[model samples]
Target: MTYNKRICVFLWLVKGGISVVLEMLGHVKLALKCVTERERIERK
Candidate 1:
């Protein structure tokens, strides 16, 4: 029973880490898009 619980906890941690990484990537992509749009407007 303890071993199963440990595995479950480990899986949860890994899932959380993956989600955090994905969120960070999404934020970075959004920031990049905003910067690009600003630059394009300035070029005009």
Candidate 2:
């Protein structure tokens, strides 16, 4: 029972870590898009 609990905790940590990483990636993508749009407007 203890081993099973440990495994569950480990999985939860992994899932949380993945979500944080994905959120960071999403922010980066949004920033890139904003920059691109600004450059396009400046060009015109």
Candidate 3:
């Protein structure tokens, strides 16, 4: 029983961690896009 519980928790944490990482990556992409746009405007 304990082994099953531990595996369940491990899977849950892995799933949650991947989601969080993906979210952060999305935010980073947005930020990079904004910065590039701003720089382009400044150049003009």
Pairs in clash, predicted candidate 3: none
- Tens-digit per-residue lDDT, 1-44, candidate 3: 99999999999999999999999999999999999999999999
The numbered model that scores best in TM-score is: 3
Q: What C-alpha lDDT values do all the predictions have?
A: 1.00, 1.00, 1.00
Per-structure clash totals for the candidates: 0, 0, 0
lDDT tens digits, residue span 1-44, model 2: 99999999999999999999999999999999999999999999
TM-score for predicted model 3 compared with the true structure: 0.93
lDDT of 1 by residue, 1-44 (tens): 99999999999999999999999999999999999999999999
Candidate order by decreasing TM-score: 3, 1, 2
Q: What is the TM-score of each candidate against the true structure?
A: 0.90, 0.88, 0.93
lDDT of 3 at 9: 100
